[model samples]
Target: MSDLSGIWVAIVTPFHNDATHSVDHAALRRLVQHLRQAEVTGLVALGSTGEAAALDDAEQDAVLDTVLDAAQGLPVIGGLAGNHVGHLHARLAHLNTLPLHAVLSPAPYYVRPSQAALVHHFQDLAERSHAPLVLYDIPYRTGVAMDLHTILTLAEHPHITGIKDCGGSLDKTQQLIADGRLQVLAGEDAQIFHNLCLGGAGAITAAAQTCPEGFMKMYGALREGQLKEARQWQHLLSPLIRALYAEPNPSVVKAVLANQGLVTTISRAPHLAASEEARRAATQVLDRVLREARHIGPESNR
Candidate 1:
């Protein structure tokens, strides 16, 4: 089984600043190398943070290829979501051709399938997928929530190895951790520390991409039973995390990355660029977090 524990960054897709706003493979590779240097446990490509919905299939495949090549040996998880069963299966078949550690999928969005149907959907997918499956339970975006029982049922499937918990229920989160069938990764950035404290595997967080060294330090301190140190890192990182989400996801995240010259601040069409105010706020918070991270010692340095 893939080790789904520790900090896995849901990396953003970098775009060129030109009119076409093409996928910046060079910048994306550089970002991957940077994250690898920061010691993130792994990478989740084509996740929501990656603006996967905006990219065509060819674009998505190209982006995944870039990520896979640049990831070196880091275990990379690819995101898959949609209501179309045939298309999903086809995508899974294509993904099976890659060396992904796992494929992260969610409940069929907008369809709001019955819990039993949800179970069937995942089970079917798991059976067809060569790679292990990590369930993505972000109800708000998916328009449907998977109950604890539903998740437990899916966990019984051998190929369903983990879950990205964004169900927004502390009870559900705790129970999943207690059940111990599937590795539980906190999908919500603010819940990473709390989830870890509750015996969760770790987090699949977009925020980690911004200040990965600080996140690595936080995870490292927690792993070594340094709760107090972990708490300090959490406090330092909270503001920046909030700021990154102050605008729609990857926009502010890209803004911050652009500020560091890693990528352009452009998001795909239908998603606006981060406002100057949001960019300034995120950059300010990021700067402060980096400054404080320096004091936490060399472990926080990339």
Candidate 2:
């Protein structure tokens, strides 16, 4: 498989307008171009940040197609957040037909299956998946955490190649790094810097959508052991990350993107638009981050 290292953005789905709220393929293509310019390693479609939950299967497929087309040659990872093993197996069967780099699958949410059941669930999906899998361990949203033992056990599968580590347990993160069996990518935006310093492979960060250049620069610096430069960039980016999540997910994110005229600030129901204060804060922080990120080029080139 190709190395799943470096930065990947959890792309937000763009809507046509608040009235119809239909998927805006044109805007999505433009957004993809914007991130590609930042030189992100990959793009993730239908993830949490992409509002996967809000989209129906057909809508999701259309969104994925648009992204795949816009991504040019960049690998695009599709999100799989199903609770039913049978359904997911079937879903993976269908996804296998597409040319995706990998699928990001989280533990079945709300159901909170046992550790043993978790193993069975993932194994079943991996068996059905033609592509490699990136295990997602976000307990806060998923309602179930994969124990270290369970994760280690899953790592034995050839197809279960990596993890998006949002389990929020320091010990688990460290142990995974020490094992060196699976590629560990930081799932949370705030932890990206700390995870990298501890030898994480990369991050599937939502905050990167706002300041892709800065995030890429930080990753480049960390990979090259440029701790001081990476630290400075992370510190500057911390505020924007905080503000982006100040509201639920893409709320503040869409607001910031809209402010920059990248996409509309229209989000589906259950997720309101970001507060004016949050938008102002994110925009202000973005301004500063973009200015600094321009200077953080590839360390090897530097």
**Model 2, residue 194: displacement in angstroms?**
1.3
Can you write out model 2's per-residue Cα lDDT over 102-219, one digit (the tens) per residue? 9999988899999999998889888888889899999999899999999999999999989999998989999998898899999999999988888889999888988888888889
Model 2: weakest 10-residue lDDT segment is: 293-302
For candidate 1, what's the RMSD? 2.3
In model 1, the Cα lDDT at residue 100 comes to 95
**How far out, in Å, is residue 214 in model 2?**
0.6
With candidate 2 superimposed using the best TM-score fit, by how many Å does residue 71's alpha carbon deviate from the native? 0.6
Candidate 1 lDDT over residue span 1-302, tens digit each: 87899999999999888988899999999999999988899999998999999888899899999999998999899999888889889888899999999999999899899999999899999999999999999999999999999999999999999999999999999999999999999999999999999999999999898889888888888888888788888899999889999988989999999988888898988999999999999999988887777677435432
**In model 2, which residue pairs have backbone atoms overlapping below 3 Å?**
none
Runs in model 2 with CA error above 4 Å? Answer: 292-302
